[model samples]
Target: MELIQVSHNEMAALFTRPSHIYNSVGFALLNAPKADSVEFLTFRDTRLRGGLILGMCGAMARSPFSAPFGGLLLTREQTAGAVEDMYLLAAQFAAGRGMALRVTLPPPFIGPGLYAKSVNVLQRLSGGCATVEINYHVDLRGVTDPVELYSRSAREKLRQARSHDCRFERLETTPEAIARVYDVIHRNRLHRGFPHNMALEQIVATSAVVPMDLFMLTVDGTPAAAAQVHRLNHEMAQVVYWGDLPEAQYARPMNLLPLEIYKYYLAHTPVRILDIGHSTDGGIINRGLCDYKESVGCRATPKPTFTVNLRREI
Candidate 1:
């Protein structure tokens, strides 16, 4: 097999079906300005296998230019051997260009076999993993009400949230509405002493291209909590950002917000799982925050980031 650089249009077409939004065309546009440059490279011989659109940072080629994690996206059904060869050839390309390789992959549930093989191959090439973060997701298959799996503590919090007159509605993803919701997220982040990494304009621009939805939890007709959801693919969705208003914390809208989100995916779309995003800062686990997610029917998966010096033996 050979590693070849393909046109942007060709890469876009192959990644069109059931691929992560972070690697899609919309994200490519958003990712371009953030990087020095970007390129599309894939493995090809008789047929095109898997590849990645990397954003260049000096001599380092990073897979995810925008979101949490994205490495090699498979374009067709291929074997484990083929997957390993793709990674090997990708490293060769990087070495030829005098570049390094840095790829971070999402949770394995997105593609079980592919992710497993990727992790093994990346580890072998790099000699070890770079970092691993705990990512949370709510499994939605073969279920209706998400509360059935919630812990008693979480259930009580949901009950308290329900005692107040609350409403959950999916907002129209207009630029104005996105800014309004983003302000709430910004406020919550500030209150909690966390940096807001993404800007309002990026979300608005991405919403125009990808399938983005806004959902809100209103108590007594007042906004208490809101969440920005992104459909990673037809089968998976992610809660990009979600938080409760500072004053609304007394109502525990955070609990109810996630529950409503789970039901929305179960009832409204082809999606079978809802990624709750990460509760980690770097590789450090936020125990308190992560425990709370588990209480609300979420499971943790190790999302790994791999790095290799292409100039070395790899």
Candidate 2:
């Protein structure tokens, strides 16, 4: 097998589909900002027989109080032993950098048990160099009826909105609207003490795959919340960045946005599953955030994020 740097054209082809994990857009955004450091290790034809994409950000700040931060990304494939091959490439890449690595593994559409097994294999390969940061996932397929899917509190919130004569519009993205959505996302990251992924212009450029309508969420003719969704594959969709303002918080636009977009995906997109990004049980440190996602018929499933301490190795 061979490892090579993947160009934008290559990623464009590989990350074309809906993904529960390993977003192409995210990769694109990261590389645009840190093109020199961010590396993509890709596997070619081999006897082990599978392909994997590993995202690496080099020379990043390592926290003395905690494991260093890096990025992990993998594409979904049908091969059962692919995880091992992926880990082999990742370990070599991480060890060479002499920096701690952080891996965020989201639940794959193949189901939870197999995902667990793959995690075990990856752990074995990365060895002392690796540790899991968190596991984030949820199962929303349990509720057959959309109405019955909501929790009691969520139902009440929807009812309250109904009492106020509220309505939802899943807006499409235009050149002008993409910047607005990015503004909401900027606020979200600022409040969370995180950096924005890319400049607003770059965000608009990579949003070609994100449905125009689902990018913006409005309440009663006012812009309330916005999020970008990407299809993982034929069967799943990933909820990427989401942002809401203080004024819209009272309207609960964040909560309602998913339901509307989900319903739209259910009706139009071929995705049978949805990955709602981070949650608290997955070590996200935000109980309210976790609870809010769960209220919309999401059940936590286990998918691990890993970290490694490499500065001590030498």
User: What's the lDDT for all of these models?
Assistant: 0.84, 0.55
The residue pairs that clash in candidate 1, if any, are none
lDDT of predicted model 2: 0.55
Q: Best-fitting candidate, measured by lDDT?
A: 1
Model 1 lDDT per residue over 1-314, tens place:
98878888888887776468887765786668888888888787787787787888888888886678887777666788998898888777777778878889989888888889889999998889578889999888888677897999899998999899999988898998898789888888899888888788878888877799898888998888888988888889898888988999999999999888888877878998889888887799899989988999999998988887778654
Q: Give the alpha carbon lDDT tens digit for every residue of 273-310 in model 2.
A: 76676554335457777677778877565545555444
Tell how far residue 148 is off in model 2, in angstroms: 1.3
Question: With candidate 2 superimposed using the best TM-score fit, by how many Å does residue 261's alpha carbon deviate from the native?
Answer: 2.2
- Score candidate 1 by lDDT: 0.84
The runs of at least 3 residues in candidate 1 whose Cα sits more than 4 Å from the true structure, single-residue gaps closed, are none
Q: TM-score of the candidate numbered 2?
A: 0.71
